[model samples]
Target: TAFAGVDPGVNESGSYAPKSVPTSKRGSSNLRKTLFQAMDVLIKTMPQDDPVYQFMDRKRTQGKPYYVYMTAGANKFLRIYYGRVKEYLSVLPDPS
Candidate 1:
């Protein structure tokens, strides 16, 4: 729901719908650099060895640092977010 560098070589602008994968913020027709920047914020907010990173790196452990390897980490976060959204699609079945 924000805009900025969400990737290294991009400055995309658009809502992040879970309809497809966001490999690179750059060259994306609807993405911007801000998106990458936004993800960078998450990197700053969270710890270097946070469980999120663990979840992201669960498949494989490269010699690169977690923050430095944000491409895979962010991709994992996105996938995790998608799963959470699906798991909690409704809050108490809409008590309006």
Candidate 2:
């Protein structure tokens, strides 16, 4: 998540904390842009069965802002991607 810069940013001073937090966006800009684009497509398609779409839709229904839902969807997408990749790699034969 942080690697993709979609992770939430930390904002604190002394004992104070803001009510709203934004993304860290410390990773590659191009990668973030690509993820946002993918999210837009998912929203346009409105795939009810897709978990990412479902998550974003829920956020939207909750009155969350556009970027908020989009970022959340992107984060969810990356998490799913990581899980599938890990599972696939776990089944690979040893190089040796």
Candidate 3:
């Protein structure tokens, strides 16, 4: 398992971080869609402004409906987060 600064626990569940999620009668595709919609609405917004952002910061998302939504939101946030970090790091010269 890959080690993430966000969480140190080795998730044996594989690359599918969303596996902890269990789809309702709506199923995976619907859940994925829900996640996408939430991410689009939430990722750019401030944490205090959105509940999903708060959940991702806690890193304790459940596998039910809320979890799926937050996972999607976190997914979008992390992508943007990584891009911002990379952009910042690229501006600096390497010490080595």
Predicted structure with the largest TM-score when compared to the true one: 2
Candidate 3 deviant stretches above 4 angstroms: 1-64
Listed in order, each prediction's TM-score against the native is 0.42, 0.96, 0.36
Model 3, CA-based lDDT: 0.51
Error of 3 at 73 (Å): 0.8
Ranking of all predicted structures according to TM-score, beginning with the best and ending with the worst? 2, 1, 3
Q: What is the lDDT of candidate 1?
A: 0.52
Q: Which of 1 and 2 is ahead in lDDT? A: 2
**For each candidate, C-alpha RMSD in Å?**
9.7, 0.8, 12.6
The model with the greater lDDT, 2 or 3, is 2
Best by lDDT: 2
Model 3: lDDT of residue 28:
47
Which tens-of-lDDT digit does each residue in 1-96 have in candidate 2?
Answer: 888898999999999989989899999889999999999999999999999999999999999999999999999999999999999999999999
User: What is the clash tally of candidate 2?
Assistant: 0
Q: Compared with the true structure, what per-residue lDDT tens digits does model 3 show for residues 27-50?
A: 345545554566656546645755
Q: After superposition, how far is residue 25 of candidate 2 from its true place, in Å?
A: 1.4
- The residue pairs found clashing in candidate 3 are none
